[model samples]
Target: MATKEEDVKLLGFWASPFSRRVEIALKFKGVSYEYLEQDIFNKSALLLELNPVFKMVPVLVHKGKILAESLLILEYIDQTWKNNPILPQDPYEKAMARLWAKFVDEQVGPVCFKSVVKADKGIDVAIEEAQELITFLEKELSGKDFFGGKTIGFLDMVAGSMIPFCVARAWEGMGIDMIPEEKFPELNRWIKNLNDIEIVRECIPQREKQIEHMMKVAERIKLA
Candidate 1:
């Protein structure tokens, strides 16, 4: 296990899935650090100092060196600790794991954005694409407790962040529960299983908070 290092810090926002991804990676790897919550809507001096270009949260500061981007931060955390390896050792498996991560990164943002807009045509298209993504996950998750098999891996961390937020937000807005008890039993089981894990349970933000955040965002979009 990697011992806690001095000056290890996370610049993140509570509601950001990007930030949660890195936070979950740190918890999973048993790394200890300080967390500074940033408001992306109101960019902080610290956030600007860390990531001037993107001006985003989730800047990982370690021993004075700064890293941005959640996936890259996750990789850095995995490599730095040398314990609780999230990616598999085998080259092929590792490749597969990365593929899933990339797929989620490219797809989930647009899907969630459209879902929140509550537009009939846009939401219909978004729902169709979202269903395809879920179907793909269902196939990937077939006969496996996790994408990394018995253990929660890199892909698991990314997926975990989104599903909980999606479940919380969608239920409130659309009244369409994505992770229904009937459909997606395997994925539902995985979500519940993850909820039971100590690290996952601890890192997960409250559902009420997420719902509130989503409501605010939706309201803002309505006015603008």
Candidate 2:
């Protein structure tokens, strides 16, 4: 019998954009792998053993090696498979992809989510913070179809869940407009572009499902 990592396997959660980034990267590269859905709120022994320090999803196993962190897994997937490269080839472009991907994941995404939840409580301050964080991406996306440029690339996959995916559903659930076209035209245009991509549409969780899940998350955040 083949060893556990003799073939590719991804331990992930459906609602987690981090792991979804890995899944999208794999799909882009046309790599075959097994998908294991994890209940991160209730960590499994395997997940604990595989990633004791962080105990996070998006843990990738390939050729018996365990890789943690969604961005790291994305890099590994791109390098491991040459076809349909995710990161750009140019040195500067590749660096920018990594930078923006990191920024969206670490900075922009959190603020956006918090803003959505807080906006429901009649708090406009969080919206201001969200706009401030989003302005960086708005300027960066100027005159570009994607952060990765013409085609969806590494940064696109990383920010996939946060932007159009989460923002679209979250804003609808809150019954408010966030990132209006007049204000963030580039980002809105980017959202339209992403919506037109079949694979992107397929990869994201359903809109109603995401909205329900995000509302549940909002409740938790309120308690916290």
Candidate 3:
């Protein structure tokens, strides 16, 4: 029983990368919306009603219509709004962006979550997985500012959503400093460019907060 509003509404978890992806798209498009933060541990009835399948956050409610899955919601926003296009107009480029978005969405978050939470065998696996994910990004973005070249597009947002996760885990938890300024120069430049953007900075969840949660989650995983 929600009131009718002629605007977008986002039901999401603050620290979730999936939620961040949708938030980034909304910011880029300048689509003003109400943001409802949901606790993953104790989901609200509203969230459950909006997205019953996964029972997850990042459910985009537009004019009473609900959209689940971050990637699909982004595409829906781009298509519906028809301004500040996230994907390239060219078919081939758009297809490539979609592929990378799918690739990163499928792999990055789960692996990083495992690294943050499970300190046992999962940690070792997550490290290797993280390296593999980073290597893919390094090669894909060899000499470009973003995956879309000079602009943060769909693929950029898709991959960039995970930046806070990797940065926090490496610098805070592991103290590994994996994404050094020299090692992944392109990545470093890209991250700086994204960080400098006002909308991106404002919408993105803080790295320190994510790190703190990661520590708590890790301990819980160990005890469990």
> Best lDDT goes to which candidate?
2
RMSD of 1: 2.0
Worst 10 residues of 1 by lDDT: 165-174
User: Which candidate model has the greater lDDT, 1 or 3?
Assistant: 1
Worst 10 residues of 2 by lDDT: 1-10
**Native RMSD of candidate 3 (Å):** 3.6
Model 3, global lDDT:
0.77
Give the per-residue lDDT of model 1 (tens digit) for 110-189.
Answer: 55555546555665675665666676777788899888889898999887777656433644555656556576778877
Residue 20's lDDT within candidate 1 is 85
For residues 1-224, write the lDDT of model 2, one tens digit per residue: 22233389999998888877788787777777889999988999999999998999989999889999999998988888888889999999899888888889878888777766766645577677777888998898899998888888998888776677776567667775778899999988988888788777767888799888878887888677
Regions of model 3 farther than 4 Å from truth: 1-6, 112-129, 165-171, 221-224
Say which prediction, candidate 2 or candidate 3, comes out ahead on lDDT.
Answer: 2
Residue range with the least summed lDDT across 10 consecutive positions in model 3: 163-172
In Å, residue 11's CA in model 1 sits off its true spot by: 0.5
